[model samples]
Target: MRLVTQQRALALTDRTSSRLASLQTLRSQIEHSGNLSPAAFKNQAEILLAFFPEIESIEWAPKIKSGSLDSFERRLQQTQAKTTQLTLSDSESSGIAFHLPIEYQHRHKHLPLQHPPGFDLIREAQWRDAIRSAIDRNMITSTRRYLAFAEDHPTDLIRLFLPVFQADTSQNQLRGLLSLELNVKRFIEQATQSNLAQAVPFEVYDNEDHNKIPLYHWPPAEIFSGLDSPLEHKTVVLPFADHEWTLVNVATPAFIQKYQNRLPIWLFVASLLCTIAVYVIVRITQSLAERLHEESNDRCWQLEQSNKALSNKMIEKGTFENALRESQDRLHDFIRISDDYFWELDTNHHFTYVSKQIVQFTGFPPTAMIGSSFLDMLHEEDSNSFRQALEKAIPKKRKIAIELRCKGHHNHWRWEKINVRPMFSTEGHCIGFRGISQDITDTKDELELLPETEPLLANESYGSAQQAINSVADQITSDRRFAQKLENFIHRHKATLDKTREAFFREALPEVAHELAALHEDAAEIGADKISELAGELKESHYKQAHREEQERLIEQLESHLEPMMDNINQSLHRQNPGSAGQKQA
Candidate 1:
């Protein structure tokens, strides 16, 4: 029972240590990306907080220079739609050189807490000391217990400060502090919430400061009132961040009564029975002595046979080792000579190994790529497809081949074809993946350009459409009302086509297509063959792939044709009525 209780205490310690280490993920993200918007920070913080229920909140306090404070406050006011000031309490406090204000905070849904923007963290002594230690050492540091305000009241919370540094600066200047606030009592309860924990009450204390009270205690001390000392006590040291916590497990009187041992009573009863059986066994041994002597001589022959078998096994082991060495050598040689770079991913899809050839292809050395997530290298649009493909292949232990766009050096995107097989342990559990990626950017571009039939048809149709528009302008030159309407029609659609390719593709193209179809019917009703033919041709042209650069080029060409038509209409209007044209121009 004592052994079981000690093991549980050690397990809880390790669990807490691992949870603290996981906070580095958030710290690394802030360092790599620099400043994160409130929305982006909240999204990431919520993800991490979901895995750790003990964490009450995550806050980001950026290191605002004195010169930038006004601008920072102005930005916060605009975002929050309220007056925000960088507030500092106890301005007379000594050893306070700078102040950092909280800019973003994400708390648990159950905890209705609000650490509004511009709330300075440097006001508190403990938090200020922790922030200084984190920045100076460039490591994560923890503050002693502090009271954090919630909507209704205050709660005791311990905070960890992780320093973030500027990624692009040569000096590696401090950017901000990322903090995680946790309730130690709740953290311990969640970590040791098992059947064993119910029997073994425990208390956790900060070993660095023995004068301080226990960080968390399982049961109230009142339960042990008027009771005797504990039956057993054990302590386990848990190292996390910058401090050590000792988890002390105690087996009290109640625990002893609940799990009492009966081994002593059973041993005494077995001893008396053994004495009675000894006399009868002494008489029986004399008759078996001669038979045992004959069997001992036969055992010598069997031992000789076993020695020969052991010699045969040793020879087999040497041959197996030689074969294993040759296999590994061949694998290394293949990776060295291959033009396509090789990579290995752990079960979480993080890169564990990359060949030196990676530098030639992606312009990133093996060291830079290692330990980074494979999904981070992929383009946003392609990440989902790769994940879906991997999910389907993993269950069946099948190989997957996919083409994806990967972000290379300087943020340039390149298409790559990846062929990978899932690696498995001897027990048939999936361990990771080994793969080779070949650059296929040129091949993909060629395939996109292969469809020339549609472009040729489009060119012929656009030529006819341009000529028809010009012919309509000449025929309607004499009628002022008709010319005015034609001019308005051209300008309205031209304005719609002038937008960015992405905007036109997603929003303007559909409306323009519908209007052109209407124009085709109007021209046919007015008995204008040329105008009707042009509208019909345009309405029939395919514009499904609006995201393509080719679509943007087409819009530009159409606008060029409209420019000439607009010029011709203006000239015709001037020739038709010199007096009216001059008055309108004036």
Candidate 2:
């Protein structure tokens, strides 16, 4: 009985795997053809249906851009091909950007179009997921159970979508989709048609992450009756695109009953022979015990070797920790040489700590700078503005940068730029400011000579350009009021607008006006801010532009040093030079 059951299981598995593999091969053939014409689509479906009769219908649902739909529809009409007219209702087309129009749908062994030519496949929820899966995975994907196409037969159906990419755009753009609808009930019947398979009942389930949900079962009613342990039976994993399905074949009640009825007679005959074999069994047991004792001794030697390996691993762990410490030391050395020095402040805006690099620029000891109020170091006029900015910035936790003149140890003022961000405590209370300050005295001196270094555009051209942009912005703002009046006029005289629309282009003028109004609104939305920004850029004097450029150059120089510090430390610890693979390895 065991031998017979194993043979039946193998037969069921072979049939199911072979069918799916053949369908996959057909998909490859269609995809490689380079052109997805209606004829090519229908031809492939016809061939698949011959081998896998369980497929109830096949469809070629091509995705069309909204801009191309009207022209594509007109081209179809010109061809004079047999088709049904399917237009979306006003509400259905709203807010949809693309349409999956069914170009060809064949069903029931015939090439008849089952749906209207342009019926949207994406409207159905299940088909929408199947479409998404195909595009996301770029492979054939199957949908969960959905209602069957035939109204009278309420059987569950599974749809699979294989994406077709356009040759011109290659894999980046999807040209269309090829889909198949399988009747689940018919699929089971076709799979288990053999007499051997029918003798034992089985079930097929979609195994998503090892969670089994019955796709089809024998005796049909067993599905609703529920399964306690589908995995307890003889289980097999049927691989599908991006998922696996579980196939379980079990012994039927009749097969079990027949086996039980023959079991008792065989047991009775075995009992009668048991006394005759007792002396022979004792001799065999003594030989087995001697073999077990030899194996136990071998296991003790293996355990002793494992202990030596553990001791070697501990030595390697110590070596790794030593290397880690060396890398950290190199990181601190890099930070010490950086020009931009770090500073931290208390909640009262008094410096709590400053890096030693600050002494190089200020000529003040690090200890002397500690506990000094940040505002007191700035020039008096700049200090008042800086304090007001910080007062507003703290509550909002805003990032800020300010220029100030600080007194050095020689009693000379040096220009500096400080960038700071508000820090917070674990409980979200305002803690203090943490920031980096860089000396910019040399940069400020060079920038002050910029007007003599570089020539500027003539004031005539710059001033006129600024005035022109500002004028256009004001005109657009005023035109928007007239646009509203045009809409109101059209709404108040709909009949007149409709008559004028038909007289001009056989379409409603009011509709045209509304579309034009939408276009105007879009123009206003885009033009206003863009013109204002242009005016500001044009009005920026030569001095302001030069000053901005100088600041950006200084920032780039500072970042160049900071960007590679960690990478340099890693290379140093690992004993590598630049332009070598060590930088790449890190």
Candidate 3:
């Protein structure tokens, strides 16, 4: 708003000049041995922009004439080159443009000549500074004459520069001034030294007598009243201060006349374009929303399909697991009922399973047969036949049957009828086979107990009768020997009796004769033997008969002694008798 307002309060001295300023700055840099670009012209814009606005007018912008800028830049280079041709008339006392403080005493060169010799820029600047300051004082003094117009407003100040000639010397020097007076709404008091660094030259005017035309190198500010414009804008970007603003005020007469009838026509066109844009945007937005809805429906369908598939897979797996469990249970029950043990083996014939039925028949738990191979548990002689049975089964793919005894758990052998069959896969390749061993122990024992007939019976009878005859003959021979021994013993007894009788009579008569001799020799002594003598043989016949009776009694004692020995021999003989078969059996 400040810029819009300031446009009315400010006007351009010449858009032509400012545009030239920008072009000249760029062209100069390009001609020199330095890098260059558009932004380098910022200082040129700042310096040229002063003519467009006063400080308090609010709006400011450069009015640049592009065509004028190119023309003037080309003209300036040609004019400057021609002016500095070093003609014979040009002396060492040459005039140059500069924008620095001057050395007061030296007429030409500055005292502090810090720059390179080719450009004595300081000395040149000194002359320009002295001349501008002198003109500036005079211009301000003259501006007082226009004080009436700015009574209620602040003064606007600006500066510019150009060369002027004097009658006294062939060089440029001080001249009179041309000045303008204006008032502004406000002063941008916080602007810095650098902000106002561009050298805004003052205008040097001719004196009122018109004796000389002085160069107005510096510009003087001009102001206008009732500055309200139809549509103009301004901008201020001075350095070293926070942004501040002011809007310009002016009378409304010019605005009413310029825009009176044309406003509605433009407004109608703008409204039509806006309606079309809004309708197009809404159509595109609706299409995007429909596409999003379609995508969401597709996502939901995919999720539903995945969930159904997972559920079906779970049902299938559960059914398979249940069937497998039932099959296993039935197999175990079959083994239990048949009084048979079942086994499974790998291709290498290592036992993989030994059923519980094995424990019932073998008097052990299932573990007893587990890890036990078929041949390892069979009787040693049966292992070869067992292998032959497996070989037979493998080729024909038939049930291999064998009767072999397995070492029972009770330290005995059990007869088993093992039936092993070849098992093939659907491809008809053999992986392994199933087998069952039934306990046939009772059948074995019954066969053993059955009576022998034919060959067995005939050989046994013949052997028994031969043994009986040999035993009887040996007994008869022993009995005869015993009888002969009895006879010899009797004869030896009879001889011994006779010799004993003779010895007893001879010894008895002598003992009695000696005892009678002793009695006669003693004359009348009583002797025990003579007094105890058999009544003294009073009767000879009685004496003879008593002697005979005594002899018979002795013979009877001898016979009693012989009888027991004879009886013992007879008992031994009876024991050895040929008919005593019962005794021999005992």
Candidate 4:
């Protein structure tokens, strides 16, 4: 019972430690980069919080020197569009002489609305101490339990602080601090959600505090009160990030009754009955003892000879078992640390085993993949090929290697190289397959980018360009207002040209020529050679009045080519940077 309680405490402690380590890694990365923008920091925090539900919020407070405080405040006000000030309370809670202020924060949706920026850290003793310790020791630190201000009310929360230091700075100059706030109740629940925890009611107390307040009480006091006195109680000390917690676990009445051992009582009764029978047998066999003694001695000698032979056989069997176990262990270790993932499939093609490394390439845990059909993870186009290959190889008990596309994270298709050999039973009958899978997605992408594959590369580029042109065409066709405005401009220009040819040539002719020349250059750049030629002809015809009818034809040709030329330019821009093309168009 004590062992079970201790295991639970250790499990919770490990979880806390793992999250803190991840936070420390994040801080180190930011420190090395020497810059932490709010958007980038917030993005990282959100990702961490998504994976670790125990964390409630992540806050980053950059260090601000006294000389730059005013400038920092002005910048903050501009970004937030409000009057912002860094507020410091009269009390000096933090041991440090200087105070730190909160700047940017990312929080879970369950948390209440965040307070405006410029929150002074020295206002709270717990947060202040955590920050001071992190900076002084150059290590991560955790705050004592405290009430956090929420929109409706205050909530109990604990915070961890990791100080960020400036890269290549003397004395390891402080750059900022990253803090994660965790809901105590939620953290406790997530840590002890196993079935064993349900049967064992537990309470966690903070040993660091003088009063020894309870941090969490499992199976709330109300429910615990209705249950009978526990059969046994166990205590465990859990250490986490500079704080010690005492965990007390008690077996529920139902659990005690279900698992209580009665072997001792049964053994005593059995011994007494055997003793009475022995006495009766002794009296009855007293006369026969002399006769049987001689026969017993001979039988004992024969049994001893047989026992010697059995012991030798047992030793050989033990040696074989130990050797096999060691070999299996070595194989598992290799699979765990290798870049590729090892896997096994049953005769039905369902996964029977998968290494933990699979998570790196597939974004899925081993437990989630087990028992799932291997073919289900393959791309539809590659599924049939893989199945056919397996079928042909399995019958011959031969090794098979194939490259196929598999569904990966976010349902994205990734190329994988798999090599497998069929497993056989003692009788040499095929039973299953063992394989290793390597993620070759990057390799495949690199090959596609190689200049040697001109035909494939050209087709991909052409497809992307065509898609971008179609997107522009759809937008233009849907915008009726733009079409109406262009029609108005053309009508007014034609009227002016017909009313007074001499005046039009003197005033509008130069402006038209300039616009045509600009269009000609733009068209040439986008590979619209036909549009460029038409525009150049129109520009040259502007200087000659003899080709009046020819000028009208040139204008019609330019108008017809203008829409396609614009589409081509839009496609060219999209090809340069597909991500921001929509934003550029807007």
Evaluated with lDDT, which candidate comes out highest?
4
lDDT of 4: 0.65
Off by over 4 Å in 2: 1-24, 31-36, 70-105, 109-117, 149-151, 167-171, 195-198, 208-213, 220-226, 229-232, 251-255, 258-586
When sorted by lDDT, best at the front, the candidate numbers are 4, 1, 2, 3
Ten residues in sequence with the least summed lDDT for candidate 1: 82-91
Q: Whole-model Cα lDDT per candidate?
A: 0.63, 0.56, 0.40, 0.65
lDDT of 3: 0.40
Using lDDT as the yardstick, the better of models 1 and 3 is 1
- In Å, residue 95's CA in model 3 sits off its true spot by 94
Model 4 misplaced stretches (Cα beyond 4 Å): 74-105, 109-116, 149-154, 195-198, 222-232, 252-586
lDDT of 2: 0.56
Better of 1 and 3 by TM-score: 1
Q: Which candidate, 2 or 3, has the higher lDDT? A: 2
Which 10-residue window of candidate 3 scores lowest in summed lDDT? 82-91
Clashing pairs in 4: none
Q: For each candidate, C-alpha RMSD in Å?
A: 35.9, 35.4, 51.3, 41.4
- lDDT (Cα, 0-100) at 544 in candidate 2: 54
- Write model 3 residue lDDT over 1-586, tens digit each, in one string: 2322222112121222232233323232323312223243233233323532322111111112333433433554554421110001111243322211111111112223222212322244432453345344422121111112233543333222222223255554332211111222122211111111221111222222133222122112422211223434232321111111222332233433553365354334434443344344345434544443454456556867898999999999999999999998997677667767788865666677778777666677767656656677788899888777777667545566779988886778989998888778887777876888888999999888887762333135334433434443454466665345443443334334344344333434233333323322321222223322321231222335556455434433443443433343334444556355334324
